[model samples]
Target chain A: DAGVTQSPTHLIKTRGQHVTLRCSPISGHKSVSWYQQVLGQGPQFIFQYYEKEERGRGNFPDRFSARQFPNYSSELNVNALLLGDSALYLCASSFYRGEGQPQHFGDGTRLSIL
Target chain B: AQSVTQPDIHITVSEGASLELRCNYSYGATPYLFWYVQSPGQGLQLLLKYFSGDTLVQGIKGFEAEFKRSQSSFNLRKPSVHWSDAAEYFCAVEDSGTYKYIFGTGTRLKVLA
Candidate 1:
């Protein structure tokens, strides 16, 4: 029973460059969500995908986008990254997008934008 | 608009001492509340959650939280803290019927042995 797993544990990119972070949800999970955690702050929701469909989005800009694959994996892509984009990107998954279902999170990807 | 506030930015306590972390939320209806712990360079882990029924909820790692409707507060508590318990704690709330969650700024706990 593996928990959520994310790739490219760390990444560095310059302004105007784009980066993609991937996540594989726990087996048999069907919902994947993305969050961004800045230094000294709690994570902020970015997007959520259920059954390969976009279910919700946060107050993020259009430059932040995500999609869930058929296998319930997900990718979060940030375009034209700015210095402020430097943060820890987290991926969480739940058996279902239901009330009271707590999300399980991955170790997260540390993104540094210069 | 739902939101959560963790008034304390950081806290320091000696190991084996009692600990309490405050959390308050703003929402129209009764909200689904949760407490999550995040260690350095790690993702958030659920400590406990409150939906309804009992106001007090026990969680993993010997953590517990009490929900007070009148105060709009869901504070986490532990009888005795351990060094390994040092981490960032976040309080989150979701609408009664929605899956969307709003998290607090988080409180960083520093345990001194």
Candidate 2:
């Protein structure tokens, strides 16, 4: 089976613009989560969805949002992008929510804000 | 409050040498622990995880980790290091009572040929 897949491997945007990143989870997986990895830092959780519902949200600003689809895929939307938002956006899929379930990740979408 | 810490920001090891990466966390209760490796320009791959039962867990890529509840630590180790193992390693813990993961800053390993 294919691993988690992400679209638009790379993206470029200017400040105040909007960007939408997409992710398709591994087949048969029902949980998808979003994370932001800054250069030289570990990934920071942004959002998590399970069964097409928002399960958890990180401490990101309101400008950042995400939603899960019926197919278990997910999209992360960022409005008013800032230079600080320039980072690698990663998507991870898991069999289910909770412990003992490992997450598989996609290559990630590198978003560059100019 | 909960957080993960990787004290070593960078480490250099010779190929065929033993390797160890340290990870420490601060939380009231024991939580799920994990080690992930990220190659340059790549997403993280699960190296290993410790949830329950065994204090020591073996993962893919010839990696293993030990969870010490008394030390609040879960450190990754490899019997023999390879050049391909040079990458950024992250330690994460399940956020208390949530599905979120709290990740440490990361340790970048540089393998010497």
Candidate 3:
């Protein structure tokens, strides 16, 4: 089966602009999570959606939001983009949401802010 | 606050040499631990994970990690290093019952032929 997939392999936006990143989970997966990986750093959890409901959220500001579709696909929206937002946005999926559930990650969308 | 730490930001070793990457976590209790490897411009691949039972866990690509509760460490080890092993390694920990991961800054490995 194909791995998790993400759209817009790359994106560029100016400060204060809004950006929407999309992710398609693997077939039969029911949970999706988003993470941000800045340069020289590991990924930080952003949000997780299970069964189209928000299950968990990271410490990001309100400008960062996400939703899951009925098909288990997910979209991460970041508003008021700042230079600090320039990083690779990764989307992960799992069979379910709970303990011992390992996530499968996508190549990620590289977002650059001007 | 709970966090993960990788003391070595970068490591270099000759091919065929043994390798060991350190990871430490601070949590109230023993949390689920994981090791992930990321190639340049790529997403992370799960190397291994530890939840319970035997403290030692084996994973893909000849990787293994031993969870030591006393030291709060889950260290990744490989008997021999290969050129293809050069990449960034991240240590992640999640609180019990919570699937969210707290990742370390990552340790970059450099392998010499």
Quote each prediction's TM-score. Answer: 0.97, 0.98, 0.97
Model 1's alpha-carbon lDDT is 0.92
What is the per-residue lDDT of model 3 for residues B24-92, given as tens digits with 9 covering 90 to 100? 999887688899999998999999999899999999999999999899999999999999999999999
Q: List clash counts for every candidate, in order.
A: 0, 0, 0
By DockQ thresholds, what CAPRI class is model 3? Answer: high
Across B1-113, the per-residue lDDT of candidate 2 in tens digits comes to 78999999999999999999999999887688899999999999998888889898999999999999999999999999999999999999888666788899999999999
Q: What is the lDDT of residue A101 in candidate 2?
A: 79
User: Mind giving the per-residue lDDT tens digits that candidate 1 earns over A4-87?
Assistant: 999999998999999999999999999998989999988898998999999999889999999998889999999999999999
lDDT of each: 0.92, 0.94, 0.94
Off by over 4 Å in 1: B96-98
The TM-score that candidate 2 achieves is 0.98
lDDT of 3 by residue, A14-43 (tens): 999999999999999999999999999899
Per-residue lDDT for B99 in model 1?
82
Candidate 2, what DockQ?
Answer: 0.81
